[model samples]
Target: MSDSQLISDFFSRDVLLGDRALKAAVADRGEEALRLFIPEQEGYGASGLQIEQRLAKLAASIGANAVDYLIRVIRNGSWQSMLSAAPAFAGLREHKQRATEGLVDVLKQGEIDSQRLAIEALGYLGADDLAFCISEFAENGEWIPQRDHRRQPSRYHLDKFYFYVAQALIRMTASLTSVNAISRCLRQFRDFLPICDEVLGQNRISGWDVRFVQHNFPSRAADPLVRDWIASDSHFLQDCGVEALGHLRLSRTSAFLLSVLEDPRFNDSVRKTAGISLSEFADAGAAAKLAERLNSASDSPGFSWAFASLYAHDVAWPACDEFVEELLGQENNDSEISAHMIYSLACRGDTRAERSFSALNSQHLHMRGTGAIACARFNPESAREALFGRDEEANNPMELACILAAQVHAGHVEKVDSLHQALTTFGELPFLRPIWKREVLYAFFVAEGSDSERGRLWCEAALETPRRVVTEMQALLKRRAREVSANRLPRSQAELASAASRESQEVKDKFDVFISHASEDKINLAEPLYHALVAAGVTVWFDKTELKLGDGLRRKIDEGLARCRYGIVILSPSFLAKQWPQNELGALMARETVSGVKAILPIWHDLSVEELLRQAPMLADRLACRSSEEMSSIVAKILDVLKD
Candidate 1:
């Protein structure tokens, strides 16, 4: 049959090839061919429903294979593609995991459209069990927005997927709301927070745009949703609702929100927000909680924001020793909150800050540096103990930076290291380079007027390190140091070379992924197929999932083929014309030959076996074919291979 005729037949009643034909098609062509038939086509009518029922029956017959095909179909298809194909595979498994995996895979892929599609499909699928997935994604606020071609300098980068997902959570699925309102409430807590406008600009007001701001504060002022949320026994959701009330900035919600703070059911975070929100309403009750929390044992750094927001600066001073002790425990405290807490302690200049800074050892660069800076600003003499440490880890660039800051602020020069290890060994993490940078600059200024050769080398090495922000600050410090230095020193070439080598080593080790797709066909189909392969012990190397931190699509594909078994190209029209996929197919074949394993698998949807080969001789040569006739056969194959 001609290609157009098959396309036409796909929409015809004759397309209902019964169970046997459906099985044959999937087994011969793969799941895409079976899924291509539009169930609601105009000509199929009631006969179409009957055909679908028969297809479902056939799918059940080869249930294991059907599951595999469903996995394949879900992983590859876009949100629209999933929406189109989901109903047929619903009865295949009621695990909730399959659907969640499909959505999470799309989100992880990081395509603006794919993320949106995944979110929208979650709503349409009407499965409440996937609510946690939605909540987790929403909390991250990392949704990347799609570029709009229609607008000149577009005003938005909305992910329609998330918007749809939110609507789905509220309107379509009862799993979250009905099963356990508490868990459901806790899951969406972040949704009510003061999200950055940058994050908000990603999603625009659509047809069913919910004025969540307004919804939290009804005009009648007695909405049950609002009331229930205010009185929810679940502390997590109540905390969120309190913040939601604050974000809405509604005076009407003040009483309801305040009432939550008094309820013993609410947690510390909720009571905190409730107090802050009620403080806006001048509710005397909120003031009491703030006072109580300030004096309470829960006065850890995590609640610094709540305290700061309430302008309880005086209350923060007493918690300094505890905060400093907690700070030494791990590098896990919220950076923003810790910064504020340290700053507050610095202003207090009490014995606690002095004792904390005095207790600093080489073992705790992060905490000692933080304490040193804070203490130095208030009591520079307190940093002398931390400054004298000789251990490389203890006397790293970060510790030196803080010690130097304290010395400069106090007008006292203590001990300065030679060559300053220009690449400070602070914290053992690459990402925390900036923190050490600040410390190094402060240390550079402290070596002023010193005749020591080590001081000169330290100055030169500090100048040689490369952080634009640190560089600019260093230039300013160098001028200040020149005024203080008894003898001027030129830049050290050996130190620069050593620093360059270390930076190069760090830069070269970055990770990445490679995606191969059929150009004309939708990306929707490729998503699930990629993920299922990943879940089924296949090391997937797709750009969407692999390269999260940066873009290295080509590099990733090449590297993946080098490391991965082989590439699975979705053999569609788009895949044929695209040079990337062709190149990938070539590489995959080469890898197969090298690895001595079947590499390129031809996955035909509606395309004939002959046509598929005609389109890509490379894929045809490498193709180790597997056919899926319907859901049943796909699941059967999956279970057969996936299970022992």
Candidate 2:
């Protein structure tokens, strides 16, 4: 076949023999076949989703085979061409020296746009040693925004360089010192790169990139800055700020968001932003807090917003269960503001929404679209008619992609033409791209198991998603690969039931936490810790509370030990020296040996790991929360564990 014909075959779905068709084509037709993808020749009309898939495929398949050609592409091609070719080195991480050298050479000599794309690829390559050198290169560089034929500037400006620098730095070195270093670097170089409109605190430093950084790599260092953003006068900034804090999902951040919902000064939009972000805190305390706010005479819709956020992520909490009846009582819930209540209850599997959903789904386009999305998530197969009924009615590409994804999420798919249509439309959605990518991936994986040609291609395509997402998909792929290798699970219901019958065992959890401590330390540690846990909405079994006058003390203590979800052992000098506490510790350890569940949560009070190692070596190995930390902080940590 001619070279153009070989390149033409790259876009042909009928030729999906395997993941490495590009590498195979290279073996047969030489390096010329790679040009179809590397520079991404024009006129094929590849959509956004297909382009991403091609990039990901090249990254996974090209490996070290095309390292020299890719390097030449970087050295000789335009910055846009360099950007197009960069994903290939991601596949070459194991053989990154040649790619890194080429990319770094671009960082030094190539244009600013080239430098930005190169540093990003370097971070992907895990090249940390070159950070300081790269820092020097960016120190004095000023951005001149890319322009169109009409001479209008692009969406992002020159200061975006700083944001990219910080992202690369964090990916290379994820330490507090590194975070602090980058924070200062931004301050020193850009003096707080504002949002150009998004404002980093010092002003608009084109912080759009920085926000993406915070979302993926949240740290305590950004806590104060994020708070200020939430407090800002601009509702837009406040929305961005609240979203950033939500990403952190710490107890203190949750507390701050609750305060925002409580405060009357903030506008409805800002309050609503605060409420939606609270979905990140899927803990009992957060849900209970929202429920408490609702039980009051207040009229904030933020509480329901928080609930739907949790439900959308597939998390359901008992704390939100009590509000379903109250949610049903709300009027005009089909309206945009109150729509969250509909999603919150529906996704939680509440039957009350059945009538409301039917009405909503049959309403006008806007309400029907909302209804279809919520219903699809609640019951995908049932939502089929609504999704497609509205699918052809809508003209928007983004809406089309969303409907396609909703259909996939609901366990339905389309013919090749529809799948290709989904591929084209998904590119229009930049932020929602990853989610839609997973939807396409799931659709493919279901139609063709991981061993099939299309399945391997889709898996390779998904590897070039965001770093955190890539890590998650890699773990899932590894696990699925292992399961495929063994293929030992029972196939029939009878076989599965027999296997399950052999392993049938159940344990009831009466308390969220059980505090075990010596009476000598009760006044200082145990009693205070007990009150704190209770205040944080955790059910605890303290001997003082659970041990009644007529109770069998030893038997009751044993019951508390076995029934609690987690055992908080207050390990101190007194606790370690006591015989009773040691016996209790032995019981918890025995439970682990039998069931293989790590249930012990240790709090070191006036005790060192070294001393504990001498007395009880087994307990010493488990990391303990230091008593010196604030009691609330300790309670927050325990709540975090319960959340997981």
Candidate 3:
């Protein structure tokens, strides 16, 4: 298409039309088409801002040819577009000198909005040479008291122009020489604290902006200000204050932090933050005080136990044994709570709680896992016996995984062969719990420490396993592998063989399969399919079973995609309508481009291939099994695909 036609198409009101137009502009005309589309003045609304953002991204992608265009946008485009284009100018290495000069000129002569954009652009561009000029603007910039034309009226004392200047100075502080100038401006602005406080009081300013102000202040000046903030009525400020105090580690404020922790009226979150700050103190008294709080708040042990754990790690807490024992003896406490108490007691070399370990095996499934882990820690023989005993009878995969983990953690090298056999047998089953797969994998990786061939094989298998394991265990395995690799080198053929085995495992993906489906399809199709795959010994990421509370859904899903060998996207009308499933599919497709793997295994669910093509054409191209088929036949097909 011609540049003007592409530009018109790119700016079309329809989302899809705009996307297609932009693609054509970039693919065919490249930088020339992007330049033609840049808005010349401050008139385009939200849609215009989005288009400019896209243009900025495209301009950055084209490198130097788009630098002049981006500079022009900074000098003439709408305020929002100028802000959007500022970072693009920062990425131009070859034309930075010219871009810098242009931005400086805009700062000096452009309208207020343009000047603000220029200041921020200079910061991002790392124009440290203009730190003095920027500092001058920050200190003496006019505080226009006019209402914001686009948004609600305000009582903000400093205008948008000065706010951007302060923001720029904050960014500039990363350069050593800019620190003094920024600090001076910060002190000067301290005079406007009441106005800033009023702005904060009225909830007009972002907590992030307020934190920026707090973070830039010199510690000597910040100490008292943060101390005052801790006392402020605003819980956000109080939380920030506590966090700042923790980072500063000012010995003098230990008493103040202790006071915050002691205050019953303070929000639990603020108290929790204060407790974290207290944990940083070197004083043994901090541990004692934390213990006192743990004792007082028997009803709410989560934060108190967290603080106590931190304190126990930092200082010698001889008193914690009694606290832990008392807490453990209580029947009302759950297995997790009891486990923490046991762990704390064990940390102090107090094995008096070992008697309670047997009871954990009978508690909730999760508690039983924790108990198994503790058993491995406190008593290895018991852990090994438990694993052997539960190998055949344990129905819950997580519980079995935990027992296996205990066996590995206890260094049961002789049992590795048997464990591997058990794993193989378990994999052939029709329904394995997703958590069990992770736990078993984790145990195998952990137990791979032996120099035996079986140990090497287990390690190799773990290294080959894809992202089916939980993030924590994955990180631990990576760290352990690095430690193992760094500690020694192979000096013989046998050693070389061992090293080669581990090396060979790295080529394989961690997970055998990832089950992707809509939550609505859980009971009818997804659940049955997931169980079938697991029973057949495939590692799968099924959301119904894998996702835990407190996980960021998108982040967890991304991790699953990165680790899985194949994605089973169950295509249904409901699945197509949901944003998350589509997002997951998009991520899987992106991964395919990088990994050169045909990763998706689509399953048709009450939908025809034509219907699927209407929603996801690329996915429709893949061979798929129908949900209407016999469950066992479908499972067999999925197993066959995984086996290959």
List per-prediction Cα lDDT, in the order shown. 0.42, 0.54, 0.54
Better of 1 and 2 by TM-score: 2
After the best TM-score superposition of candidate 2, give how far the Cα of residue 592 lies from its true spot, in angstroms: 18
RMSD of 2: 13.7
Model 3 spans with C-alpha error above 4 angstroms: 1-70, 76-84, 87-104, 107-116, 122-169, 177-182, 185-193, 197-201, 208-241, 245-272, 278-306, 312-314, 321-644
* Stretches of model 1 off by over 4 angstroms after superposition: 1-263, 268-345, 362-369, 381-385, 388-644
Per-residue error (Å), model 2, residue 400: 3.4
In candidate 2, what are the lDDT values of residues 183-290, reduced to their tens digit?
Answer: 343232232223223322344433365554443333433433342344446565566567656654444355567777767787787677677667544344455555
- Tens digits of per-residue lDDT for model 1 on 1-644? 44344445433333222333555555655644544442222212212232334344434444445554544444565444444444444334444566556656667765655565456445434455555555445545343333221221111333333455455454332222232332243234324222312456532333224322122121112232344445555454455456545433333343455445555556666666665544332112222345554555244322444343222123323434554555333335444334434533444333444544543442445556655555544444444444444233444565554555554444344433432333333322122323334344434433442233433333332322233223323322322233224332222212222232332222231212233676454355567565555555545566666666776767765766666433445666666556667667656644432222344444555556676534432234333434345434433443343243
TM-score of 1: 0.26
Instruction: Point out where model 2 deviates above 4 Å.
Output: 1-36, 39-71, 92-102, 111-120, 123-139, 142-274, 280-304, 311-339, 349-352, 355-366, 376-389, 401-421, 428-430, 433-644
Best by TM-score: 2
Q: Poorest 10 consecutive residues of model 2 by lDDT? A: 488-497
In order of appearance, the predictions have TM-scores of 0.26, 0.53, 0.35
